[model samples]
Target chain A: MIPARTWPLGRAGVHLVLILYTALCLGPVLLVVMNSFKSRAGIFGAPLSLPNAATFDLIGYKTVLGQGAFLRYFGNSLIVTAGSLAAVLLFGAMAAFALSEYRFRANRLLGLFLALGIMVPIRLGTVAILNMMVAARLVNTHLALILIYTAQGLPIAVFILGEFMQGVSKDLKDAGRIDGLSEYTIFFRLVLPLVRPAVATVAVFTMIPIWNDLWFPLIVAPGEATKTVTLGAQVFIGQFVTNWNAVLAALTLAVLPVLVLYLLFSRQLIRGITAGAVK
Target chain B: MDQIDKLAADVPLLPAATRDAAPARTRRWHIAVFLAPALLVYTALMIVPLADTLRLSLFRSVEHAPVFVGLDNFRVLLTDPRWSLHFWAAFRHNLYFFAFHILLQNPVGIALAALLSLPRLRGQAFYRTAFFLPTMLSFVIVGFTWKLILSPLWGVAPALLGSVGLRGWFHPWLGQEATALTTLALISVWQYVGIPMMLIYAAMLAIPGELIEAAELDGITGFAQFRKIKLPLIWPTVGICSILTFVGNFNAFDLIYTINGANAGPNFATDLLGTFLFRTFFGNQLQLGDPNMGATIATMMFLIILAGVAAYLFGIQTRMRRYAL
Candidate 1:
């Protein structure tokens, strides 16, 4: 009975810690977003407060939108991310299906070879990749980014999908086989539908990093026409460092879409990670 | 049905009907068809390039011609004081960055994860989402955002410091040689702490309630239970997190590059191995590009990562027995 008294105290302490930590996590982002809406003087004066009617300013937004190639960068990011995710998922799933389902002599060796990419950072191979891209005349194009990202993303995607595919019910495939369905038909018409959740997980896992990556974009596709959102914002903000309003506004603009997407899919994303997709 | 059963019994089972039987030629062809495209793409794009990078390290470019320099590029990178200083500085900086991450990021993550995992914690989902929000955003956002917040001109830092009545502590941290790298490392820690927290929280959840109850019965609760029981049990997860953190930190480039440029400056304090390699591969204002030198640097980076992974796998992993719940 005496020990019961300690429970409330413990609960209160836990709540206190969580609340404090949550504040720490949210504070900087909140400050940035709030200040992005205020005039420069208002931001400096009351950094903690929200934008008031009198202090409200869209000058920063106007400047950022006016000078930067924001829309083009956004479009480029979308194309690269979507293109890479599509290639990785399709190829990864197919390879995973074969590796998991078949009993070929070289099956283990093939899987091991694929797993090697997981450990070796793809950037280490940039020298040859650039040379190859130059030789193929693919530099300064979105195709360069897409191809590299697809290759980079495939190993983890295949690894995760393979693990998930191993747990798929074999009875369904067997039934398909007995019904005169071809192996290809079984994989596509039946197996693919069942693995939609894993697909979502893989998409989330692969999309964020590719969208956020800076190296390949800077090296292989840094042309003005091919700049990704990340590189675009970095350059834009660097060029206008002294313009406080524009800098804050550009940073906010860069952060907003991802923030919205994250809030929408946060659960699925966390679920995927905790599900051991990368582990 | 009786006649059909009798007919089936009269015939022996075909080889294909057996569970462990070899697949027919047609099925084998199907396997190859499914596997070929992905293998072709992965090998052509990833494997071939990696091998070529290693091979390129052994050769030098001479007047639009390639000459085999063998170990000369590597020797210059390692032995010559000019290149070696930047290489070693970046290497040491990377190690320091990694050490800071392990010390601060992992512990803070573990602590936050522990609190979040409390069985009856209120607003758990909200806390989880908020904690993870920064991680989903791009490094550009994180880098520039932190830079603005800490900028002395912006007064955001001063204001926050003023609230706590410690306004004298405000300085331009990102501009200081001593503080720049550490400050950036801390920012990175802030952005990524969510990952380890969520992972560790998941591992903690996998621990059974019965074990907690048993530990509680033995008069262990809170931190005591964590240290005495939970810590040992979560060591494997921690191990995995450590190695992941090692690789990620060693490979990290964007944040520093975005925040500090390829020079990684304010006197190169923030320069890491990634930035160093980037500068070497794509020549900066001060130097012409050297592919052989860049390849040598990359090979060294690869070796470092390999050694670290090997240490984790053989040295740390084998010693810790993962508890099966």
Candidate 2:
């Protein structure tokens, strides 16, 4: 039998390690948010404490919100992320259905071609992509980011959806065929609805990267109207680097939305990841 | 074979009664139809540009037009001191950045994952979620947030150091040539450690609990159990995590770019291959942009990544012998 005394010691040690790590992980983010709420003097004086009545200040927020197109940047990020997700899911599912359900000579080759994109970093092709966008007169526009992200997001979406689709009940598709449903109709009406969980997983995986990406926005859409929250925040903070309060507030603003969304979807997000959906 | 015959027999209106008849032609067309749109877009956008980038590296742009100059761009990039120094420096810095992640990030990730996976740990989900919070935020945010918190003017770092009676040790870590790249790498490690942690945690969770229970009955618990029993079982997952870290670290851009600027300041000490490529492609304060040279750098990056991936596939992955349990 195990030694009972040893078990308590081991458990305590585990908690100790965990508690320390948790602090290390959350400390920097906490420090930023905490200081963002304080006046410059208070921030320096009591950096570890929460903002008190005298120290609480909105000057930082006022300055950050006053300068940069923060709200516009958020809207641009949302539209680009949402658009990319919709395209990747819709077209990706359709392609996956065909690859998994149907037999064709080039089917395996096509899948392999799509899978190659996963291994290769898409940013390596930025030189040509910028040129292509310029030729098409689409530079500094949201459409450019949307298209590029859609292309970037497609391979993973198709890979995951295709793998999941293979496990789907084949008898259902056969039954739909017998009911005189066209392949297109079956894909939209039956198959799409059935794979909702996979779609959700794909959305979480795809959206976070797209929403957080700074490279594309910097290169393809850095104009005032099309700047993403990531690019906008970077530029905003860079200009106000000397202003500690404003910089802290801007950082808090950039981090808050993602934190809220993450808390809401952390469970599903973890489940999706551990399910081997992305890998 | 029987299913094929049955499928063929169902369509009795066709001229041929055999299973391998005209219907196969229509079925092929149907498959093509389903696969067309996605294939078209991917090829047009991703494949074509990548292939073009590889091709463009061999040509020099002369008066806004690309002219074939095979190996010339590569020669200039390698032999010319101006181009070669920056390229080699960025390359070495990238290696250092990557080494930091492999050495620090993955080990820390594995350790946290191991602790989090301990049986009956209270608030396990809360710890997991909170720990992963930084990974969800944009790199731009992570970069700037750390930059501000560590700024000498802000006093957060100094105050934290004072709490531990080490206030004088604080420096402008991001602004110093000696410490800048290493600092950025550590900040990135802090933000992304959750990725490997979560991946390894999932892999550890996948190990059969009955095996652990059996080990426990044999007096295997705590560090002894972890070293002798758990580590061997999770080797393949660790291998995968290493390769993932390799690829991710090599391709990293936004963090360094945001925190240190595209120049990767303090005299380019923090510059990595990504920033080098960006500055080469899009001219900064010092130099005119050169597309051909930029493409050449990108092609080199592609080759490096490909070689790394090939090594992982052929070397580490094949040897890691995953446990069936």
Candidate 3:
């Protein structure tokens, strides 16, 4: 039998602290989700109680579906996020590969230059970005958000993926070179697949901020047709602030897609984030 | 497993200095091809806009056209009573916002990480996922969720407090002048504590098991073991997390804007640089939007962030890199 551990906190104590925090973190979210399924009276009258027959209602979801073009907003977000992520992965990986594999004079300087955005937010230039978007007639376009997200994601992508690519064996690339495979083919067929885990990590990291962002969408795409789901929820909630059921349902709708996707990819996300962040 | 699958933690992304440069300079077209797409998009959207924002700050729009008015925008922002009052208040509130994050969020995150890292803990996976759930949700969801929970009319906060014999402590936190900003800060902490916890946990896991076992053999265990052995090794992760929190807080807007509205209401008690910038750029009932003055505020934010980042990269990070092992 293992000896009892000598610690300031007993095992039970540790578990208690964890449980309390878990509740604090999860209680509000669960409260919102459950109440979204309840009637307005049910929500305020019995806030913590799980939905029963008396409390169950679909009115909130109906209001949300009837009013907001949330589906269209979801489509816009999907387009922008997927497009930007694809661009970030391809462009960011290529840049990372070049910086890592090629021994050049300006390589370090270039790497440092690209890494600047990791610390400094791209939002600082929103004024000029809006100007450029209007001038280019790209305002209210998914392309505008996608291009900005690509730039936003590239720095950290290069930072993380560059590290992973540096560890890819030089021998394999050299063997491919000897096999007379073109360099581009080597990158596509060789390096990218080899760095699949890192790419997964980068995808989740790059996808999140783009998805949850309200600022650019609010500024560049506030028109009814161009709203992303996040901006849609914000606008919807703002208009329906007094309508509790609709507000909760709107937030729940905004939340469900991300939560569902996260549940599906949690393993990959957890592994990838932990691996990619290694010092 | 192939070599790539056997990733190790010790390797840095880019090495310090390579003495042997590659000899093939003739067929170098792929290099530009590899880099230009990313560079072009990044420069056009990021670098060019940043430069133009700086330039725009030095100009004023006269009859829908920009006219160069050097230092005048800065003077107005600093000295003009109309602009300066809001500017100074927002600046002061932003510091308070950052302080609450640093003092509260980092410590709580560190504590949770320590507990989660304990040996033989049950439900670790569930707790990790659950804690990170709020972080995954958009700030809109988080803000509204907390808003409903803390609403006095909804009675959840009051009822819970009463159950625990502290009903009087419950107030309309989001609507009160004295408590509004702190309430928002705590709500934000709840949403984001997962980040630092996860980062530190990752760093802790990266610590070699044998090293920990060796410490146990030396009769150093539990909190003492953590204090002496684990804490020193994990300082770099803590440092990184702290800086991340600083950057995130200074750049924060969504929660305050969503829960408190863009006016940062309760008489501007919760106004931050981000919300201030948003109000200036976009305008509200009281003020019409002015892009030049907005750019001026953005430039100031840029310089402040630059100073913090430069200090971290040069001062703290270099020192911590040595302790990362």
Best by DockQ: 3
Better structure of 1 and 2 per DockQ: 2
lDDT of 1 by residue, A126-158 (tens): 998999999999999999999999999999999
lDDT of 3 by residue, A1-279 (tens): 224584448878888888988888778877888889999889887888998999999799999999888889899999999999999999999999999988777899999889888887999999999999999999999999999999999999998999999889999999999999988988999999999989988998899889999999999878887899999999899899888999988888888889898888777887776775675
Regions more than 4 Å wrong, model 2: A1-9, A277-279, B1-18
lDDT of 1 at B29: 86
Off by over 4 Å in 1: A1-9, A277-279, B1-22
Fnat of candidate 3 is 0.81
> Interface RMSD for each candidate model?
2.5, 2.4, 1.4
Question: Model 3 — TM-score against the truth?
Answer: 0.94
| Model 2 per-residue lDDT tens digits across residues B1-325 | 9999986777775555454656676577667777787887788778888999999999997888879999988898888999999999999998999899989988898888888877767899989997888889888888887877788876778888988999989999899999998899899899889888888888888877788888888878877877778788877777777777777865689998988888989899999999999999999999988888999999999899889989999988888776777
CAPRI level of candidate 2: medium
Off by over 4 Å in 3: A1-3, B1-25, B318-321
Find the 10 residues in a row with the least total lDDT in model 2 chain A. Answer: A1-10
Relative to the true structure, candidate 3 has a C-alpha RMSD (angstroms) of 6.5
Worst 10 residues of 1 chain A by lDDT: A1-10
lDDT of 2 by residue, A148-206 (tens): 88888889899989888888788998899899998888888888888888888888888
